[model samples]
Target: MGCGRPFDEVIAIAPLQRCHVMLSWCYLLLSATMTIECLDLSECQAALGMESGAIAAQDILASSSFDEASVGPQYARIRTDVAGGAWCPSTQIDQTRYEYLQVNLHRVHVITCVETQGRHGGGHGKEYPTFYMLEYWRPGRTEWQRYKGHHQNVLLKANFDTNTAVKITLDTPIVASKVRFVPFSEHLRTTCMRVELYGCEHKEGLLAYSMPSGEFYAGHLFDDRSYDGSRNSSGFLTGGLGQLMDGRTGGEFALGNGIVSDAANAEQWVGWTKPLVEFYFLFDDIRNFTALSLHVMDSSNSIKEAAVSFSLDGRHFSHTLVEYFRYENSSVAPGPDWLSIRIPKQCGRFVLVNIRNTGKLLLISEVRFESGDAYDVEIVTDGPFVGRISSPSFEYVWLITGLLGCCFLCALLVTIIAIRQRQRKVTSPSYTGLKSTPQAEHIAVDLKTGQMKVIRDTELWLPFLNAKANSTNVYMFDSDKCAVSKILEAPANVSSVQPAESASTTPLIPLKSSSSEEDSHCLSRKELFFENMRSEYDNPSLHYAASDVRIVPLSKAER
Candidate 1:
């Protein structure tokens, strides 16, 4: 059944052969299999729903004389919010042959696809681009490149049906910082269109590199204390990275503490002593970076002017690569702002930050460099770092709680050990051994220092005299091994006697009764009494006699 075949060839094919060929083709078509796969529609939607980096755009202007009350109100409809009404710029009387819309993306992106929606109003008079072309501008380029298709075709068509949304998918993604849409439509008077850009916010092939170490310096003088590498106080001064990158725009001046330039002599005042300062960043590896950010202090008098440059080698730098950013002091109500410098993508290992002090004081709070996949380049500085969040985190609270608990546990253990030691001292048996010598004269002994003490109390001295007088009967000793006197019971006629000087050298002797019969009887009684007292001293049954004090013979030193 081939077309343009000769008549003779067609006639030669038999009816049976043609039928077989048709059956074979039908079988082949029926036997074909396709692989089906599920797609994450939400993920796709999320990618398409990214916020457009477009800060400003052409073709969004409206003439003040137009019927519309305000100009550029329609520009709001082109943002990420789809619920907002469409952007319908009133063409009014003036119209151009080739109307175009140009968008400044602010930063580079890899554009994958773009979608366009017509006005919500339904009518045959609806306006949209019948034919169009997409173009984009790269960094450092003055010219635009025409977006191409998979087959290298530079032209594209969109919105053939008015009032209907159309999506154009590019065969190949383009890396660009700005994009433009040119509409060549017959409906030029109706210059209204809603467009959305869908793309990866970063280039596909680039790898995200970690932040690098950084140091601060004043001109040629390096300050070792200026090195800082932390989340909160990433700047050479104070504050953190989160606040610096909060995207707050600025125009007025306020005062606060942050990174301030210091002279080699710490006593020298900043700005006056050191009019200029610079920060140096060292990358672990060379990187192709495109943007750098600086967050100045909240004062107009702080960080008035700055410049950034890159170099493969730190010492030698190319003048052509230098970018200057200046703040005009003459401006009314000028304040601190986050300034981002977009540079042509280039590979380098070092970034030099230079600042000129226009105000009486110079201070900068934060610095961030945009490198691989737009990851922030890290800076290392000598710092007393602070946390990024003003409020404490759960982990910090938990850590502190744990430390306190540990301290309490340690203190409890120490207290328990001390209490147990005291209990042992109170419960355990205590015994003390003291040495003494029986003397005819009275004396006292110091128990603590093991020294002989003079008897100042007459009762103590009289006990020894009573013991010597009563020596004629029997000797008696108290629990402390000191002599006890029964002087009140002694007869009044019995004279109190004093030992002679020889008594110092003589051993004390027990006195006996003079009458033999009476003495024998008295001696028998006394011996019986002594035997009973001796049994009492050695008795294990005497529970209260297990005293902590004891007496033994005096040592040579005590004697």
Candidate 2:
């Protein structure tokens, strides 16, 4: 028998070179002849040990510069290989935290899946650990943030036989120029075989979706979740407290053709050529307002610019030029359009708006009015001030002034008349004394052929004695005290004596008595004298005497 060699000595084979294939086969035959069991380390120890050394070596190699002599040969000799055993480490994997890949994400899409080949025990035991995790970072960002890979719950099993795929969605839909992926767990450490991205070239009038469709809801003016007052519907084309065309009441505007489409049918055409509805607003007080904004939607259910106009008076409108926007414009259409007009001051009562078509569609589900500071400072200040002045207060002022003026004028006229009456009373003529005890003084004269008689009663004539008379034929006496002493021959036409005083007093006296036939003759004589006085005083063409005899007083003796 051949002498048996020690196990350590037999297993201590020399490292093989390029020509060691034949030597390795001879060594295996010698080990089989020894009749010993071929034992291997547990899977956990095997994987951990292999990965530790490989990871360290790879870190060093990856840190080295890619000089032509060193990395050139390695890169050319790189080969594709499948993982073996429970775990396999990727030779080309990058472990740098800041590393990223630049890609043209224009119309591009990428999908990823993860699968576990086998389970590793807990704390080095043979058990699968719950190790589902994901992380991502953008180009400009420095550190990766945690992210949910998909809506589905993550599942782990002790003995995983099938693959589990996790889908990730981009937070923003963008044409990304670059992207970075950070793995959450070591199980997904395999090298990325390929990346797929999907998108379309920029086009005009291309619609991503219909705004009026059920997928897109309208936005609200005040409430973040609601459009208008309705929670179930989408937002309107315009918004505000006075959004309605005819004041506070709102009107109807069609949003789209009432059709729905999906991503498969994207890039479709949908839009409104004309305004479906218009509104007119009149701000009674321009001071209360500050800014105006509109929320609109496109065929893609995106907001777009809507034409707007404002006015001081309702008749004349000034188109407001839009300056700012909240969404990005697509090459296919004119804008990511929404209209917002800032008012620097209040526009008194008249704000007129015309909602021209949103570039994409005609459907206007809702509108909103956001209160703002007035744009026009002058209008804000002057409008209310001028209106108040023209209101009831101004009218009241005018009325009060008018009434005061009338009262003043009436008072002035009364004052003037009173003054004139006082002056006349002060300058009026006066009369003076008569005999103290005398009762009556009487006189008579013959009455033949119209001779006149004179009787005096001093008491009766006292009041008129001082009055001036112009004619000598006139005489005065008091009828209450004077009496005729004798009866003179009656005139030919004289009638019976008529009472001097009667109960039925009359201002005019007849010259003729009723008792005599010749009374008409007496009347004729009296009429002649009356006519003479009338001719002197009543004629427009003649100048009358300064002092007439009828206005003068006569002495009692002449009576």
Candidate 3:
């Protein structure tokens, strides 16, 4: 401690020596603190949990399987579910290019790179793909598109031999739910593969966009050349994401693979001749929007203002927040978003951006958003997915049961009515082959107290007419008295003749008749007083169980 201090003079500078020793301790402590702070785990983060088997077995799939017991799609896990050491197709070889191994990430993710390997059945399996192509699909889409980098190459270099995992980082990150790996070779050989996807959860939440088409000025086509959407008959591009959301800011230069293709190019920007442009964005998931960032480039400086709004459904929108672009600071991150515009505080899945250009031409490069999946407070009646199931509430169950019961009873009543009408039609005199003129009604017979006689008005009818009418009512009388008179016809007003005493002669009635009524007014109100009363026989359409009547003459053998 006294290596550089004088013996006698040390007493005078003792405080300074103690101060210098304390400062040395502080320096060492500071250095140690700085070292601890610099050690962060994010810097050395490599793979996204594939080699460690964090992905589920069910999430991985393949086009075909060589053997289900060993090499099926579920066994396609990176390093864990190696049933036969890897996934191999049913046809292992020499000619086809249709086989592919697929992985469903379950949700949209920001994919940064892809890692692939081959089946390593110890030393026996020496097969591997030299090159492979990637195809990816997102939600709300039907087709799987082949991925192309800035240079527009599809085939990616894989591995020279089995067991060596080849890693390739993408120049343009993919945001999708499913990605498939298609293996390829120049000549012919059996192809099989095991693969892993690397990425983080998607943050942008955008699914698609619909916007007005870019313009064609002079000899140049100032269009969204890299846009993957279709143009409508009205010259609008819709239902696909494109260069505006590709994370590239467009200006006077065109760049491909880090090389300048043109110095005065504006291909990344979608331009229009109109003074205003409308953009509708569809998100992959619901979000709480905070602000928006629009990157606009106009060499003529024609742009004036912009505004934004949001919607829970695509049809309804919130109030548009006006041109507050100049109010907020323009110093934003170079990529994704450039000029920030604060939007209203709301939660939704759709966004509308309106840019008002004060000049004749408009150019827009990119549109990036500021949003989050976690809302401060929200209540959703429906989810991101929908399905149908049997209702659980008994309140609705009772209502449905009541309706069905009413329908069944109504149907039973209708059936009974139809049957009664059909029986009446079959029993009618007209249906039994009897003919009577409109003015000539059928004959009738009546009996009472062992005495029977022809109806007073029907006495003029022919003998056959009496027999036929009697046959229709023969059940009203006994068989002993059913014999017809020897006279071919009956004379009118023949009340002097007496009836046979052997006949029971009780009058038939369809139903019991009440001896009394509560009020004669009830009958008069319904027109049932005396002769006004209606009976089943008065209506030919009515059906009633009736017995046939038979006639007999008064003569005996003694005569």
Candidate 4:
């Protein structure tokens, strides 16, 4: 047989090639289908979007109407009999039902407009009809969420042949798939005619620019003498020293003292801003910047306690101390005329130095940002040190002592007044009777008996003295000559009678009269008188004739 190519072999190559081409076409179609489905539009509509121009849309949901049966599936029907027109019973049945619409979307860029309308069949009685809108969504992989958006005022008006449209802009972007609209009532005929949406992109970052001050240069010039720079030696410059105050400028601060001197004859340049004052020093090139020097002098002298701070960004700062010096007889000491602070590393473009004078005087002479190797220096001073005599002032110790003295004086006065009051109370006449007095003695003598006696202390006395008969007998005698009579009356039943011729010589004793029963049975008038007088005298004494003594029965005397 001839070696002709078999028909099967030729066909086999063609079939194989067709199969390969078909398989390649199928692979491409599959890849394209997947790409279309996997692509995400949500990121473009929200904050994560690749483009920088996207913004969010405001979503509004539902609203309400005062009338019953106004906005659901059970549409309201007007009744002519009622003044305001009542919704019919049939129409009220539909009020509970609702008419809702839902839209599913991948990404929502912006909501364009919302338009609604309501029926106005009732007479002028029902002026306007109101409705509401609702929005729903599913965020990320989460379930459905809903929100309400309604205007304060209702949209539709009664008997008006027009619809109301509301527009809203969102403050933030949202990524959602579905949204919904819901009405408040079912009967007051209300409808949403249309809703519109627009795609959007994100916005880019804000442009950075330098803020300018109205003054010239980066440092302000302040004239110490007059209001203006010409008259006053000092004037204020807002931005560094070179730029004008009105327009924006990028410059560094430079401070120079008109004359260089020691602490005595130094000039000061003061620059003050709001709370955060920033000073930038631009170097020609990067070098070994070590120490920063500032010539600062406090004019008020109140700045000794003031805190000095340094900073890089003008936001954060570090603190240091300002040393004070007094010259003696033109002899100068190594005082800190310029503050030398160490800088750690070289900064880019410019170095910002912030000086916050927490002290009384904010005056500065010159500030120098020097390269440590270059030995650069700056001097700033508030002119010459003018001395002013300060008046004498009271110290805290003196004030405290004066207060204590006043308090002590008040306490002493109080004590004296208290003592005087106590003394007056004791000496007052009202309490005199409550006090005790010394007793006085009194003596009484009996004239007829010539006897004397001593009376014991007495304020008051009782009449009728009774005693048992004893050998040592009681005597009644004359005040002067009753000694013999007392001896005779010492014994009971003893009697003594004077001789008739000697009656005048011896004292006569009076005897009880037998005829007078009153005198014999009771106390005599003299005894009663003595008893009554005893209350008036401190002490009393009585004298009687001893010859008158007689023994008698007690029962007879008592009667």
Q: What TM-score does model 4 achieve against the real structure?
A: 0.21
Question: How many Å off is the CA of 29 in candidate 3?
Answer: 47
Error of 1 at 50 (Å): 8.7
Expressed as tens digits, the lDDT of each residue in 1-559 for candidate 2 is 0012221121122211323353354333332311111111121111111122321222121122223242211221111112211221233233332222222222212112222222121223132212323332222123433333112222222122212222333222221222333222344233221112222221111101112212231221211121111112342322211111101111223323443323211211122334333444433222223344343334223333333444433344443532222234343233223333544332223454444444334433233233322321122111111001012345667978999999999999999999999998889633212211122222222211222223245355334332332211222221222312222112111233222221111111122222323222222222111112222112221112111212212122222
TM-score of 2: 0.21
Report the candidate with higher TM-score, 1 versus 3: 3
Deviation of model 1 at 420, angstroms: 74
Best-to-worst ranking by lDDT: 3, 1, 4, 2
How do the residues 136-164 of candidate 3 rate in per-residue lDDT, one tens digit apiece? 88776557767776456777998887778
Q: Write the per-residue lDDT of candidate 1 for residues 1-559, one digit (tens) a residue.
A: 1122221232223222223353344334333322211111222322332235334434233222122332232442332333323444445212245435566666666566787754443343354555667777654233555665534465566665545667776654555667776655543355445676766544222211112222333442221122111222332331111112212222233223542233322211112225567655544344555556655443345555556666554554434344543445434234454555654554455566666666454534345555542233342222132111123346767988999999999999999999999999999745322211122223222222333223345463442444444311111222222222221112122233222222211111222222222221211212111111122222232211212112332222222
Q: Report lDDT per candidate.
A: 0.40, 0.27, 0.55, 0.30
Residue-level error in angstroms, candidate 4, position 447: 14
TM-score, candidate 3, is: 0.50
- The global Cα lDDT (0 to 1) of model 2 is 0.27
